[model samples]
Target chain A: MFLREFWHKLGSPKWFYQISTGWMIGFAVAALVLLVVGMVWGLAFAPADYQQGNSFRIIYVHVPTAMVAQSVYISMGVAGIVLFVWRMKLADVAIAACLPVGMMLTALALFSGGVWGRPTWGTWWEWDGRTVSTLVLLFLYIGIYALREAIPDITLRGRASALVAIVGTINIPIIKYSVDWWHTLHQPGSFSLTEKPTMPVEMWAPLLVMVLGMYCFAGYIILARMRIEILLREQRTQWVRGLVA
Target chain B: MILRLFFSELRLLSRNKAQVLNPLAFLFLGVMLFSVGVPSTVQSNGIYAGAVLWFIVLLTNLLALDGLFRRDYDNGVLEQILCASEIPFMVILMRIFVHWLHTGLLITLLAPLLGLALGIEAHALPVVMLALLLGTPALSFIGATGAALTVGFSRGGVLLALLVLPLFLPVLIFGANVINDAVAGIDNTAQLYWLAFISMVAFTIGPFATTVGLKISVQLQ
Candidate 1:
């Protein structure tokens, strides 16, 4: 019952705004500290790969951004479901907040992967499975964003974008699988939960930190954006007017 | 009632000769552009021909999709259908079925001729038709959802392509791979199965999503 109440309370924009300030600061600091520590360790301290040397350090940036980019999309999909099933307005806000950030991160992942590939694979780009799927992902984000921008009605916009997000989520795995089956020039992922890490502790430990930091950073950015969106959306409300004034 | 609706849709589509012919013309034009742009030496490559054929089919399907719901929505037929039908899902499903019959099925039938023109081997021509036959309905179904979503906009044509093309990638990949495998004398059952699986999924889900989209569009109107 307590958990249910908390969930209900979290749905309230005013309550969310009131509570998220502290969280925003905490996440901001945590993301900064963790990312700095992880980047410093991974980029400067970790021993280089014998084959690719220091060029492999790009993984520290590439892996985390890629992982976080996909995670944000999945979360938006979940948010899409919540918005549809529950008609929770905050869920729409969450999607709106996270979308541009996710698009940027997906772009960043592609760029970093390309940069990493130039040295390791001797090409900046290849039409391989992972790369193609990631490009599709970026397109998916842009499509949803464009759809949202095209619709002026708030309710229609919310529902249409939510539906697209849900459908895109279902298609993502199928796309990945089909693209993988079509052609696979990229190496299999180095990180998997079911198996042990291929690299040593010194390398992966920093990666773990980087992953966590990226998540924290995403949380901070999304929350900050949501709070502002909430205010703009609710600018006519008494609480918002009082807060703003 | 469902059969009546389906036949009526077919009759309505048949009345508009341009609606049916334009996409076919576009398909022919697209193929012509590709044949002209690429050297004859490259055109004979089976893999290249297969990819080009699949891409042109996709674009042709996309060309036809913009009109899928726009006509109905514009005339208030969609709103009336939604309001009157006991099951809007069936109505939307029938609409998509009729759409596939005109666009996807026609394109599938024409693919062999186009494939030959593109220098796909005589032996592989059957595979091109088969792949397209298995694949184009999925395109129609998936593209219908985009059409439904953007049915309200005056300028939804470009936006529809933007939204639907990415989703079309898997179908395009599997469909083209089936032809490529067939060209090389490799068994292509797996790719055909994948296309069938995608088509089935789209068939099941597409109408429901399009119904929801229609409702949203109607509500806005």
Candidate 2:
């Protein structure tokens, strides 16, 4: 019964706004402190790699962003499922809030990956499995964004985008596997995931911190964006007008 | 009922000769332009033929997609069908079938000519044609899903391409590989099997997705 009450309260935008504002502030501070500390430790304190030297330090940013990008997509897929199944407006807002941030993180991952690649592989881009799959993920995000912009109706847009998000989620594994297979067939000596990272704990500890920090940052951004969306969507409501006034 | 719908759809498309002729003409011109644009002497015959033909077929498939629903949509026939039909998926499946018979099947039949123009070996011609025949149904089905999704848009051509083409990549890869393998004197059966598998998957999912998209389109209207 309490869970049901909580679920009912969640459907109320004013309740969500009142509660989420506090969480948002707390998340923002945590993300900021964690990010600053992680960057300082990883950039200044970690020892240089034996192979790629300081150039390998970009992994701290790249891997975390890549992980966050993938996580955001999975979250959107779950939200999509929720939106359609439960008819939840909050889930739609969640998807709307996730796209811009997800696209940015995916782009950052690609850019940082490219920077990491230039020194190690002598090329700015490599058609390996991870790079190709991430590139496809970027395209999927663009497709969703473009589709939403093209549709004018609010409900239809949400439903259509939900369908697309679910489809993209299903395709992610297929895309990853196909690219992996294609890479293996043509390029034998491509990157390997099975080989464990040889980095010392001194190096990886800060990398772990950065990954956690990025995820917290994602949470903060998602909540902040959701609050704004809820306000804009419910602007006609008395509570929203009262808050604005 | 499904067979009748399929035949009527075919007949309706046939009456508008441009619907039948334009995509084929587009394929012919695309093949000519692509072959002329590339310096054909450098690349091997198999590589050039396989890549160019697959891309042209894919583009032709894309071009044919919007027509699947646009006419019925503009005529209000789609709304009528929705209200009248017990199973809209069957109606959608029939439409896709007629579309493939006209555009995709015709492309497969005429692929040999395209192959000859691209200097594909006669031995490899059958493989290319077979690959296309097995592969284009899935292409049509996939395109139907995109068309259904974007049917309500005034300017959906570019958006449909963006939405559909990435999804079409696996089909293109497998389709082209068969002919390339044949050219390399390797057994092409594995590629054909993959093509068949993808086509089966598309057939299962495509009509269902198109039905959902159409229902959404109807709601928006």
Candidate 3:
């Protein structure tokens, strides 16, 4: 009675899809608007680092992508807990949609980081904690995606892959802290929910914008993908056929 | 009953000698090839030496781990183990234990020779071996957890690598760090203890997950 009806509606796929559409379009528009803003600011307006010069521009994309890659996995873990606790099938499907986007963002992080590293660290690769651990996060995302696609039975695959995703969640913090704890070239966190960004407002304001923009884009991409995944996986189900027609 | 059944599974593993040795051979051969291939300059630097050694070890670990719980899934042994055994959990548990004893322990025992080839100092051999002894089991166990989670499907062995290796990172970090520190004549006890703690935690908790995973894998199969 106290917190009931709102949460209850989310249990149904139709309720969720209908409800989420508004959020999806809103996020998509917001992401597009901010992506143009962030890129323009980052590529054109943001001042170059005194140390690394133009290469530091990579941070605008790299850090945000890596950060979102991590948050997406954390979201998937929460989805796992949701499904495991409430047996919400839709939550599992939603979690499935998060995997590839997380992976792509991880790839973006790695690519941008690697390019940034060529100038900063003077090496294409290093076993420095943050670099190596972020690389591992990329693998974990691939594993989640592969596990889902590998199994033929959609529902069963969803459950099994969720189990793997939940287990892999243990590594997220390790990746985050590895940069701080270990002797590494990678920089530490900025703009955390609790902690203030280390840089001045000039740097972090744009960073804050990029982070929010990426979150919204991630939302849009995952929702779009989930709609596709549902259509593909549920092609044989009565509801899906009705929707298709 | 599970012990008897588990031995049969081990026998099934050994019966395919290629399965067991191929990966380990890849480990050895890759190390040998890399050692041969790298310019002497890079090989001389301690930094590159350690990175290359760990990289080879990681790759070999992946190769070996690809076999974890795979054949049994193929043979329907996993399904039988799930349904027929009263202590099916123990059956999954016992298989992983035997796997560690066989693969992890053997690789660890061989780490010194590897250390020697990789230009690791003689004094550091002990630390590297100790790290491997504690660390490889963690890899094997976590790998089995991933293997169990992914066993029934096509393309899963490769996917299993992606899934499990990230989980393998902490041990790699500490294991390599401990070795690097020991070589530098620095105290590495903290890293060593952390690696062991991770191994212990995985050992205690991994079986239950593997058990549930086996059930899920088999049922889906």
* CA lDDT of each prediction against the hidden true structure: 0.89, 0.84, 0.77
- Whichever of 1 and 2 has more TM-score, that candidate is 1
Measured against the true two-chain complex, the DockQ scores of the candidates, in the order shown, are: 0.79, 0.53, 0.47
lDDT string, candidate 2, A1-245, tens digits? 99999988877778999999888988899899989999999899999888789997887898889989988998998898888788889988999999999999999999998888888888898877778778888988998899999888988998888877876676676566666755532223222368654566787789888988999999999999999999889999999889868
Candidate 1 vs candidate 3: the lDDT winner is 1
For model 1, residues A1-245, the per-residue Cα lDDT tens digits are: 99999889977999999999999999999999999999999989999998999998999999999999998988899999999888999999999998999999999999999999999989999988999989999999999999999988998898999989888888888898999998888767868989998888988999999999999999999999999899999999999989858
Q: What 10-residue stretch in candidate 1 chain B is worst by lDDT?
A: B39-48
Retained true contacts (fraction), each candidate: 0.71, 0.31, 0.57
TM-score of each: 0.97, 0.90, 0.83
For candidate 3 chain B, the 10 contiguous residues with the lowest summed lDDT are B43-52
- Cα lDDT tens digits for candidate 2, B1-221: 87787878778887888877888899999998987887756674557688789999999889888788998898888988888988888888998998898888999999889999887888888888899999998889878888998998878899888888877777777787788788888998987987887788889878888888888887777
Ranking by lDDT: 1, 2, 3
- Candidate 2's DockQ is 0.53
Top model number, lDDT: 1
